[model samples]
Target chain A: MSDFTIAQRERENVQVLELKGYLDAHTAPKLEEAFQSLLNAQRYNIIINCRDLSYISSAGLGVFMAYIEDVRKNKGDIKLSNMSAKVYNVFDLLGFPLLYEITKDEQEAFNKFAGSAR
Target chain B: MKDDVELLSTFADQATVAIENSRLIKKSIERERLVQEMTLAQEMQRKLLPQGLPAVRGVDIDAISTPAFEVGGDYYDFVELSETTIGVIVGDVSGKGIPAAFYMSEVKGIFQSLSALYASPRDFMVRANAVLSASIDKHSFVSLLYGILDVRTGRFQIARAGHCPLLHVGRSDSAYLRPDGMGLGLAEDDFFSDTIEEHTLQLAPGDACVFYTDGVTEAHRNSDEFGYERLRAAAGLADGKSAARMKEDILRAVDAFIENESPHDDMTLVVVKWLGLTA
Candidate 1:
């Protein structure tokens, strides 16, 4: 019933997820599944592209919280990018900017991953 | 041919009966699970509530938490720090059901234990945040607004952490009191400590303050949110009213606005009104 989707791809050895539509309680589990798969494959250097994401609730934020530790434990990072101001406000409200590396675009996030990689 | 037809009818009837039996069994199992969850949520909510708002001299206080069907983690508690001071908190944790209950209880415990140790509102938050970051999961955090109200002096010092703004209505003007702070468990000590600032309010006679979770403003009907403007207006309308009266007015407004829509999140509110020292 939730109008949400996640597109997963790998570029330059970084796992990138493209989120679309509303990411509320209904859609959080789908995001959780995506993260689970990536973790299973040991894909830690991740980028979440939120250009198409229209809304995100605390449930959606929880998905990110639930996984960040394992990703960092592997010395990998999850960087978010391409968030609209509306989407950014939700993250900012919770002080997520302090814990997550959020960039303006996917390219920027990828570049940071590249920089860290080198 | 007649005998074969009778056999087929009997077979079909048995199959239908078996299917219905299985369906009923599955439904009962699901219902059982839901009932268990609701009970746990209720217990958790009860634990979070104050046994009863104590009769603090010169102050009238009341709070409420209305859980949605799914039962979110909205928490509020009053800690009697001293004879004249009360440590109050209203907070919301992400998620619902058992997970929410666990996180809410953890936050309550952490805050409850620390309330006695720190008299300053800011110090309480800083210490609570440190403990939460270590104990709470990264995906789970609580947005808490903590205040130490000294009833004797009518001094209310408050600090926010990713919670909704506190609506304060005085004799002449009403404003939302929101000091800068992030939710607990989102950041470490240095960043959390840096971003948080404590604010103080001196309550005069006929002053009213409301602390609530997002469920109030976010309460929606047909995709239209209640919003901050409406909330401010609702509270302001009851300016100089008793704390209980203002709480009722706001609840009524929210209810009318939602209009047949069941709330999607837990709605919690705390109302405080100051009256001149009890004669």
Candidate 2:
């Protein structure tokens, strides 16, 4: 169950998904759905809080890749924060650092998005 | 009167022997039926492997898996995710026989369905781990190597979830890619993944990367284990060969090393080569 809760702030246009548990073949769908809902709602600027994100697989990364193009086309972006080294290593191997904006802390990710909007 | 008593005892003894023989025959038949079911299951498992590697430009892929009994725990799949990218997965379940094979099927379904949609190896593994942990029994776990090969760019992004080292054979010798991790499905949070290590080898165009299950390295010869050293040597000898040939070479070498002794466990191998770009 690699699922998380989403809290959106309309004023800042920041959508944050608090991810938890393992992200593998079985649980990837939940994340995919969260991503799609955010996209549908036009909440493009996103931050995925990985403080509780225990593990991630290629399939989980695929979800992010699937949505990146859509978010970018909307002139919005997805930034990840509080990623464990295990999760980060997965991103690094697939060249996620090049495609997406990653930050060390949630505040930094949020701040970056806030600054970009300004 | 003595003759009559002896004759009656002899007849009773003969009758008891006849009944026992009939019971033994029924038991033998039951055993044969069980063997037949197992054989069918093994055949089905074999069919799960790709008939041949997809003809992807700039990439060479081949794999083989042999069960110790009628069924095995190891499974591998090659998914054509896109025109240029190919998804490769090799996994081994905790145990052997039907239980492991069933688990392998579950894992395979996830890889097959999600590979078409997902792009990153790490993300795929994380999701898979959670689901497997939830569904599998407490005793079950898996070690896997799941990656996507960008044939156009000659780059592959691989994630290791407690599998064997993927070996890179170059002009000089073998260098193993040891990623951080343990087997999946053990715990929801327990994980180890590597920082994406990139090995660009345009200079060594014929170099090949080999992925194998522990059964190959842990094969036994009498009391001495076959070990990784022998497996590495065989892989080096198989360098620059086609994916199919490389797979064959490794199996043949293992067979020779053990001198036809049956493998104590399941053995699986996959080979990928950088064939340069297609003209």
Candidate 3:
């Protein structure tokens, strides 16, 4: 009975995606489509804001792994920011900290892009 | 008029029989093709699974994989990294059937090719994730545990990615060791690399570790799942036994639990028992 959704916006040439609700096997494909659309549009720099995400499973996490190579190969990066502790724990437990640029807030994530651009 | 009616009825009956015959032939052909495909899939899956566990000094190793269907995604393999060390892995791909089996083979290829290159479990996972991220299909991922065991010292370096907890039964008690790691094809770059943590455990004589797929825990009877508690208990009870005996105990327990119910998922179990230097 869990629900999941994604919202996207462009900020300073970075595609910011906001995830909400539960991300499990059933809802993972939605996230995959969102990423696929971004790739199709040539939008590579992505920042996922997980402040409202209630939960996530390994299948949901696989979506991010599926596209990271293409995004990076295209000279862009996927960054994460503003994760609730519950959602963050899932990432942290999986060793997400070593493989991602996670910041305290969205502004910091944008700042990272700005800094990288310079 | 009566003769004309009889002639019309005969023609209609003949037409209906011909149509039915054609449909039956088509159906049989389709069924035949499906049977052929399933047979091929089964053969391919068998080849992908590990042929046998390697014999190592002071270590007793045993593994088994049983698919619920003609083809399954569960996999376990041992790669001889060197004369002194061996790499062991157990993994499960999401879903089942031919697609899952095909993906399992792809994952096996990746593991075989990359295990030789990256000695550190963490580094190997990072590289494996990068490759899998690009290659794996949407809505599908693999949960795996990779470890290197040194035969001489009984030291195991392990890394897990969203798989089931690694069960360890020591001299006193049994416990589940869950190190931090994500599944393959889940994330890329820093997200994956930063999230996965490596763990090391030294096995003394009488120590045993179990690596398994979710199928073991998720096995069910009626509406009740066999669950992890039972699996841990089984492993604990079988601690002092040989690796082969432990494997049988676990499978037998699962079979008894399920009773008349058939397995709904592919089950895989790998048991490693350390006998120390003397034995």
Output the number of the TM-score-best candidate.
1
Q: Which regions of candidate 1 fall more than 4 Å away from where they truly are?
A: A10-13, A114-118, B1-23, B188-191, B276-279
Candidates 1 and 3 compared by lDDT, better number: 1
Candidate 2: lDDT of B36? 92
DockQ scores for all predicted structures: 0.59, 0.02, 0.25
Q: Candidate 2, which CAPRI tier?
A: incorrect
Record all residue pairs in model 1 with backbone atoms less than 3 Å apart, i.e. clashing: A65-B139
Candidate 3 is graded, for docking, as: acceptable
> What interface RMSD does every candidate have?
1.3, 11.3, 3.6
Global Cα lDDT for candidate 1: 0.85
What lDDT does candidate 1 reach at residue B144? Answer: 89
Alpha carbon lDDT at B83, candidate 3? 81
**Reference-based lDDT, residue B40, model 2:** 81
Q: What is the C-alpha lDDT profile of model 3 across B2-41, one tens digit per residue?
A: 9999999999999999999999999999999999998899
- List model 2 lDDT by residue over B44-127, tens digit each: 777777777788877877777778854767888899888888877888776556777788888888788767766787767767
Worst 10 residues of 2 chain A by lDDT: A1-10
Top-lDDT candidate index = 1
